[model samples]
Target: MDRFVLTDAQWAKMEPHCLGKPTDPGRSGANNRLFLEAVLWIVRTGSPWRDLPATFGNWSTAFRRFRDWREADVFKRIFDALTEEPDMEYAMVDATIVKVHRHGQGAKGGLRARPLAVPKAA
Candidate 1:
């Protein structure tokens, strides 16, 4: 799979916030750019971690790294930094184009009138 590549401007924004730099105390990450690409691949394709391509390294290692970064809030920081300038121009949504499934419309009797039983605690 062709991995996602961050633009120079985007990388500049995220570089400082990422973990495992050469100056960092712990074992340095193999390559922050490649790691980001691996993460993007998972998110973009919506694939299970185990399906990660061999070029990205072991799937389990990537998943563990992802968990560690999540715990440290690195993803949130990157999002905030990159989205600092809100692009309101493209924010408008056309509700008319949206569709809802028939079964999701709720029962004929409505929600409140439906018979609901409370389970007894075991």
Candidate 2:
């Protein structure tokens, strides 16, 4: 798929957790992977639903599907499945070494005071 976000392996992990599979009794979701990509696009760009591009399908339909998934907690299950094993290799943070400039720590006189003020000419 063009402009794809989830790799094949990642989609494999999440596919089983998604609803409306062809094997199921109810209506099968049309292109679940594409729907997921649409949702991801919205999140990645932080854009409003109306701004969703035409490539991902109708924005309203995708939004409704997102709401349904949210209500079913499908996203949580997907997240849990993908994060079963915590990868800490790149998650480490060194908080021991830190530096703060003097201006950052409520400098003398504070920032509320105006540094320059000029009288208006009549």
Candidate 3:
């Protein structure tokens, strides 16, 4: 199963905001898209960096790069770029599917229960 989360259009939107273009002074990122995918995979699966797939390259390297990007606000820039035109297709919440338990609906003897008064000291 393909685990990649970024579509080509999304990647294009975020590409310019990523660090390490050949024009930058420091060493360019080997493959920014793959690195971003690695980070996304970790997030999507809620897995620790140590469990990153071998296809994403060394887990440590990916983690370190993620740290750098976080500190540099690269991810924020990418998010901003993508949100320029938000997609609301999956944003709706269905009220019918949501359930309120009896306790949650202010059932008797819950928060309404009065606390017993402390005995007066002699």
Candidate 4:
């Protein structure tokens, strides 16, 4: 219902391992439909897990599942499985390009680098 649900085509594009499978009895529970929906929402909207809508189930539950999946190497496996292999025959080629006038890489600044301006007393 107006949730960031994944279309059939998109779901099919994902790795089979990432898809929901038949859950066993007892230890098995309600399908993780809402959980997957929440994850899809996050991937689509790039929002934090805590920002997940309550309608998609508890944010903590979704986060826990995410963590579990991550710990179980599900994410990597999914990525590998869904990814297509490059089409290239057995061939080795190398090329080198020369460039002049190179500058040092920029440094990353931290929060400490940015300070709020102090207001003057009126």
- The top-ranked prediction according to TM-score is 2
> Clashes in each model (backbone N, CA, C under 3 Å)?
0, 0, 0, 0
Q: Model 4 Cα displacement at 108 (Å)?
A: 29
Q: Where does model 4 exceed 4 Å of error?
A: 2-5, 13-15, 25-33, 44-46, 85-122
Model 3 shows how many backbone clashes?
A: 0
lDDT of 3 by residue, 32-114 (tens): 88888888899989999999999998998889889989999988999888888877977877967688886778756665567
Which ranking of candidates, highest lDDT first?
A: 2, 3, 1, 4
Could you tell which candidate, 3 or 4, scores higher by lDDT? 3
| Candidate that would win on lDDT | 2
74: Cα error in model 3, Å? 0.6
| Every candidate's CA RMSD | 11.1, 10.4, 7.1, 16.1
For model 3 the TM-score comes to: 0.66
Best-to-worst TM-score order: 2, 1, 3, 4
Give the alpha carbon lDDT tens digit for every residue of 3-122 in model 1. 357887999999888988866554336677788889998998999999999998889888888899999999999999999998887777686766677776777765566567888899
Model 1: CA > 4 A from native: 1-3, 23-28, 93-122
Q: Model 1 reaches what TM-score against the true structure?
A: 0.67
Error of 1 at 103 (Å): 22
lDDT of each: 0.83, 0.86, 0.84, 0.65
Give the CA lDDT, 0 to 100, for residue 55 in model 4: 81
C-alpha displacement of 7 in model 1, angstroms? 1.1
In angstroms, the error of model 1 at 107 is 27
